[model samples]
Target: MEHPVLIAIRRAAFTPLGWFAPGPADHAPENAKFLILIGNTGPEMFRRFARESGVATKLDAWTREAVSGLAADLGATAVYPFDTDPPWPFLSWARRGGAGHVSPLGLNIHSVYGLWHAYRAALLFPVVFDLTPPSPGSHPCETCVGRPCLSACPVGAFDGAGYDVQACAKHLAREEGQACMARGCLARHACPVGQGFAYAPAQASYHMRAFLGARQEE
Candidate 1:
């Protein structure tokens, strides 16, 4: 039988990437014993997103409505990476969830999806779900010495030590940046892991636009 969470999100084209029990520091939902990290593995979810909304704007809003409903039905609470004046510590939770690792590009890399996957929302349950904790896979970046992801950025936005947001944004706004804008981050594209799960061009372009837009507003 499908895991309850899997079944609930399947129609929406989401999946349980991995999960973990929340500790005191996790600031988990009140009485939340488990937090199931919800996300996508490839471009498939983007197809559903496009088909349903026609327009790709306000994905967080659409996600809130969809996943929140699922949470309610499961008697759980939903939280998102995009939440609030005080953003929830989703990156920390993801690290603990066993599927995510620190990547040179400052985005979480997954063993199976590498740079292409993304966390959409998480369902926090008061009662623990019947799911086994996943074993943390060896960090893919460890074995890859050349680390092409760091060198592929046109503006050298990622310097291993930190990410230069201004440098990245400035480049993305320029006419010459059109290639990256229409595709995705050059650094992300350079990651050798999980090439098979790379996002479809349309999906990648959508996210690239979204990232640039958010940076412009800041």
Candidate 2:
């Protein structure tokens, strides 16, 4: 029994609006019926939609309900939220079950857009869609053995403990982060995949400035 929403998701995947990026793992449960691949909305789009929808007051809860409702309407047996932090217990359960991939807030090759990409939401359907996971294995960082991202930082913010957000904020405070904030967001540009996924320099600068300003406020 092919699900209608699953079909819609497949069609959406290839369309310009879908923004679908393939996942690394194959989700083939014996009872699995459909697979829905949802991609994150760009940062700009998220802001715009949130403002216009007037659901701004309840954005977070609204997003969850919308996804859950979509799954229920589609008759999906399971729903997976990719690329964002869901409840910790749900995340643990998903990991133990081998259902999907959960990415951190920092760098990843699969999404060259980097942390700048906003994961507004996602809804995975249990309808089988016959799509193959990305091959040649996952984790593009594996090929970047020297880990250029670690060295590219002007302040060594990405030390052994992932990204040093406070250090990065402090640096960006002075001279508006002349080293990495300008034409060289090192970690972001370092990503090999989705080179075309980069936000415009002006857009990047705006975000950098906002992030730096927010950090100063903190």
Candidate 3:
């Protein structure tokens, strides 16, 4: 059975990706014994986000607010990936929890959600729950390689080693990138891992536009 806390989070539209007990080296909250990584896997979260009437701008602020609100009820401290004041080690946390691995595109790829998933907030609780530990599933990028993600980009933005942000941004803002803009990331779409859990077209477009907007703001 899923823990009440995780179930509550899912009810609120966030997927609890995985969890782990923080080691001494992990700079977690003083009394935090456990951490549950949470994020969106598909469009349900986006649907909820869209339904909520807000000029709250980016999904970051909204996710932080939602998770923090839920955390309070569960007596947990909610930390976000967007928190930069002290900088939370989300990537390391994800790796430790076995929820993700660094993929060729430089994005964290989940065995279940592939490149379509993203870490939103992590819940830190003082007590550990009786939940099964996440297994480090077979990496999707490994075995049977015709890595289409490497060649899917029109501007060759993702080259396994690094991503060309400027080139990607320029493409996204132009007519030539309309297919990607209208649907989703070309490279992300090429990944066969979790196509079943892929984001819906509308949700994909929103993120792409948001990405382009953020690049423009930068």
Each candidate's lDDT (Cα)?
0.83, 0.47, 0.87
After superposing all C-alphas onto the true structure, candidate 2 shows an RMSD in angstroms of 7.1
Please tell me which model should have the higher TM-score, number 1 or number 3: 3
lDDT for 119 in candidate 3 is 90
TM-score of each: 0.94, 0.53, 0.95
What TM-score does structure 2 among the candidates reach? 0.53
Model 3: how large is the Cα RMSD against the reference? 1.4
Per-residue alpha-carbon lDDT of candidate 3 for residues 28-105, written as tens digits (9 for 90 to 100): 778889999999988878888888844346788788778888899889999888888879988889888889788999
User: Which of 2 and 3 is ahead in TM-score?
Assistant: 3
Mark the regions of model 1 whose C-alpha exceeds 4 Å error after superposition. Answer: none
Best by TM-score: 3
Tens-place lDDT digits, model 1, residues 1-218 = 77766787776688787788898988777788989888887876777778877545577777787788778887888889888857888888888888679897789998778888889988888877777787658899999979999999989999988999889889989999999988888898899988998887888778778889999898
TM-score of 1: 0.94
What are the root-mean-square deviations of the candidates from the true structure over C-alphas?
1.5, 7.1, 1.4
Candidate 2, residues 105-150, lDDT tens digits: the string is 2532243343334332334444444443323235455455666666
Candidate ranking (TM-score, best to worst): 3, 1, 2
